[model samples]
Target: MHLNRFDDLAADVSRGLARRTSRRSFTSKVGVWLFGAVAAPLLLPVARGRAEDRYAGEEGDPRSCDYWRYCATNGYLCECCGGSANECPPGTTMSALSWIGTCRNPADGKNYLISYNDCCGTAQCNRCSCSRHESETPVYRAGTANDIHWCSANESTAINCTVAVVLGAAEDEV
Candidate 1:
């Protein structure tokens, strides 16, 4: 009645376009999701800790998370194992599994290590450092209840520690 012949052609073209796009972009969709897995954390401008778990001072003993001490350059902290770079963060030079790239202090040529918290470990669930929306700071798990929260204590300039090394020590980096 009203040029129905072209209607079917238009419908066919629409389906064809959809099918082509789906097939061609299948991997890209998957890759984007995969890339987001790690990109979320690395892209953080400044990995800020939660207010509930904020370090007041060296209260519990040797303050574990030293902000001023490590003073990460590339948004990374330094976690050492028995004062050895080998036992430090995964990418640190001192770590035996020094698979990570090397980065030295701009002021001191001495090699430093980028620290890493056990975001995924046995004690706690794998905290996805990714997010769909941007927030003011990074979120961490820190409650004495069943769900425990902890981060990698790196070498920092802080004279005192708010927390102590309870996990992932030199002998325990297995």
Candidate 2:
């Protein structure tokens, strides 16, 4: 009796699976394909517009750390040193690690979160030490603090943080 009950259960499950597989009719498949084809083109422009909106910035002197892009900047400006706003100096390397800061872009009137990674393997760029702190804390709170030297993790010697370069930007969380 138990064996017969098990066989009946197996047959019921097999029938259920067969029904599920057969439910996707030809009309349903065509409807789904048609919906995707019609919606993709209409959605693409909106997606592109949102991406463009996140990258808005104001025209300002890059040499000054208080430039529109450097709203929450915490270290020396790379432009003041031998490097541009987004690049490290000739000999120095841009560190993979970085700190996050939220800077308001005057162009779009939106706050953008930027990654400020230090350029390692060079002397500290002592020129423009712009300590514009937004969410930054003291070195005791190393996770959020940009004042602490970040190059020590990448460089062998105890080199301090040199130029701070804008690695990337995105929309602010809040």
Candidate 3:
């Protein structure tokens, strides 16, 4: 009988402590609660994602930043396919290209095709960058056979998606 009474008392005490602990979890504890509040923003996103996203394409230009490597909405530097974009071999272009209806010239009415140099990484410095443009005169024309190009964001193409039905997004103006 005495042993049963002791057991009952022990169980009651255990239940009370459990209830108190649960209730206390949400309370405003001084150092711990305030520290957690301060650290929440930094921890929330990290808790949501796994570790692979941070180093997806590290093999190619380890510094390059992309969707998988950096946090969403945060901007970071990224690498592209080659040396300076415009200076790419013969067929490559140094600009990112979007479809335009028969590319038109902003300086004059004459239409010509072009694309955006979304990337550049070579002697030419034609990488898609914060500002993309080329001066009429080459900055470093060392020899007569020099090949170079500049990354241009304003460039566009005349390829119409509805008509040709090929790859690439619809014409984007800008």
lDDT (tens digit, per residue) of candidate 2 on 1-174 = 377754453345333223222223233233323333544454335323433222235444565443556655566677667877777877787777777766666666666666777777767667665555666667777655776666767844333234444444555454
Whichever of 1 and 2 has more TM-score, that candidate is: 2
Which residue runs of candidate 1 sit more than 4 Å off their true CA positions?
1-98, 110-174
Q: What is the number of backbone collisions in each predicted candidate, taken in the order shown? A: 14, 0, 14
Q: Which regions of candidate 3 fall more than 4 Å away from where they truly are?
A: 1-37, 40-49, 53-154, 157-174
Q: Is candidate 1 or candidate 3 better by lDDT?
A: 3
- Candidate 3 has a TM-score of 0.16
What lDDT is reached at residue 71 by model 1?
24
Compose the digit string of candidate 3's lDDT tens values, residues 1-174.
377754453344334323222212222122123334444454335423422332222211212221111111011122332322112333333344322122233223333332322232223322222221221123253111112232333243211110101123224442
By TM-score rank, best first, the candidates go 2, 1, 3
Q: Could you give candidate 1's per-residue lDDT for residues 41-114 as a string of tens digits?
A: 53222223311222232111111222222221111122222221112332322211111112232223333333
**C-alpha lDDT of candidate 2 relative to the true structure:** 0.55
Question: Lowest-scoring 10 consecutive residues by lDDT in candidate 3?
Answer: 158-167
Highest TM-score model number: 2
